[model samples]
Target: MTPHRPSQHARRLVAALLAGSGLALGGCHADRIVNEAYPTTYQQRHPIVLSEGAARLDLPVGGGAGGLTERQRQDIRAFAADWRKNGRGPVGMMIPDAAAGVHSSPAIRNTLAAAGVPSTQIVSRRYPVDGPETAVVKLGYVKLKANVPHPCGLWPEDLGHGGGDYYGASQNREYWNFGCATQANLAAQVADPEDLARPRAQSPVYAARRQTVIEKHRDGEDTTTNYRQEDVEVSEVGGK
Candidate 1:
């Protein structure tokens, strides 16, 4: 047997293969240089949306003229007051047509007016009621409300389907449904949706408190406040 060695061309080919592999690895490193990421929770990104609330109030058709009782008048007053205070759009009083077997009466108009709702907003429309019986009157208005279009508690992947293989858990990230219900509840509880958009004007400064602080500072005494703490009863926690 005779000793044999790699030819020049063979050595050159091996070197080319090694250089190609190095170039491929360098390309991969370049891609990783700009791969910065920040995983954000769905709750933080998707806040509650608000809309103008609108609905019609169905008052008894007979609650007009002398037909309206004292209780009915009180309810109408309350409704009108609320609409005037919190309603977004024009508060309208819709009267049923005479052909509907009920006509707009003086009592209905008077009750709304007494509550400070203007008379110019009243309008009338008729719809075919199957029976000749009296129909209910409608008062419609729009109010502010907070809402979220997408509901919570959706699972795109099963938990135990692949032996606890979850992307959120693996990445130490919050689940998609986390804090969604809390956000929705907060939105519904908001009295005014506009408050969420902008802060209200600051209240006037407390003159008495300001004077006390000023006197203390002038006398070289500590300006820190001694807060009044009263004992609060906690019995209600276990009560009915």
Candidate 2:
């Protein structure tokens, strides 16, 4: 008599093992939350704006006031337009503690609003960390599907996948390392609409820098899991 083949259940277990291995090697950081859980795809396709050129409207840096020349102001206005077209605009603003006094002035609001951004979207908040008294201006644009896949949901890496890290334990912990940096990089590259249409390759320097950033940010960690026991059980039951 011919030997009996392993049952379908056994096959499924083997497949799961292989798939999990592939995910690990490919850096798939799966979150506990399923993709179906999200009610809307808004988060999936959201576009983040990047600050390009020099920052305009210098309030204060370190301890001194930052001066914006007339030419620089023009450049900033132009850059703001670019950001508006590509990213979600005027979402909000951030002020470092040192620049709090100057940024709160009414003149700054009038200037920014006159430049084309709506005043409503400008949210002012204390800088989360100590650094330059930079403005966290909200830029605007429609969301676009990620052209590449990402490992963890936290970041939309060039790989192409998307998801988020759903952890109850560290909900309050600072997870600064997310898709923001990638979105910013992509924003810089696609600042010009023409560049968005034309495809380009990452330079060696860029690749190196990207790798460094990913490592520093711990970009891929969520998808890691252990299904070895399940696989073993299936194999034992099916004798395969």
Candidate 3:
């Protein structure tokens, strides 16, 4: 009844004041209000290692030499197929010798592209080292999650060798192997399983002891790649 006594102009003025007050309050609590009222899409993509950027190539001799069998080539092709599904392809292939039957990086790139992988993802390199080398082929890709579990059983020791110091000073001789396995498993889970299998190689322990020796000499205190997962989370935001 009391409002009925007010003129239309007065009513409009009061309404305008109320609207202005509401807007001011909303502005003060903007972030909270928006967060509560309209949640955004909070998503995280997995990590991948690009062959084009981080790969190294050398002559495949003296510790890098081993001929890839037809079966091995097929396996590599299969692996490439899987990676292509994840919008990636083989970034690099490390053959023992440049003259070996192994295809050059460009050839591998073309082959992968024909098989459906994007051309930008392929890389090829030959190891340059000298003498009785084992054949090593490296494939690179990003990981899907921040933490992935490794399969060779965490911290297993070779009883035949000294414990805790088998690989020189490090407690785990298979650290890099385990680390790679862990990353591979995580990548497999996040990406397609097929792509995860392409770069598969013999376990570090199974490989010739010479490679182990080289790895030990190169250990240099650093244990794993940047993509390697850690035991503890350093950030508090994601409860990580």
lDDT of 1 by residue, 174-198 (tens): 6556678888888889877889888
**Model 3 over residues 174-209: C-alpha lDDT tens digits?**
232334554555654654344543665666564565
Each candidate: RMSD = 5.8, 24.1, 23.9
TM-score of each: 0.69, 0.30, 0.30
Query: Candidate 3 at residue 209, lDDT?
Result: 56
Q: Lowest summed lDDT over 10 consecutive residues: which window, candidate 2?
A: 143-152
TM-score: the better of candidates 1 and 2? 1
- Provide the overall lDDT of each model, using Cα atoms, as 2-decimal numbers: 0.71, 0.48, 0.48
Q: Clashes in candidate 2: how many?
A: 20
lDDT of 1: 0.71
The candidate, 1 or 2, that scores higher on lDDT is 1
Superposition TM-score, candidate 2 onto the true structure: 0.30
Q: Can you tell me which runs of candidate 3 are displaced by over 4 Å?
A: 1-68, 87-90, 95-98, 101-110, 146-240
Give candidate 1's root-mean-square deviation (CA, Å): 5.8
How many collisions per candidate? 0, 20, 28
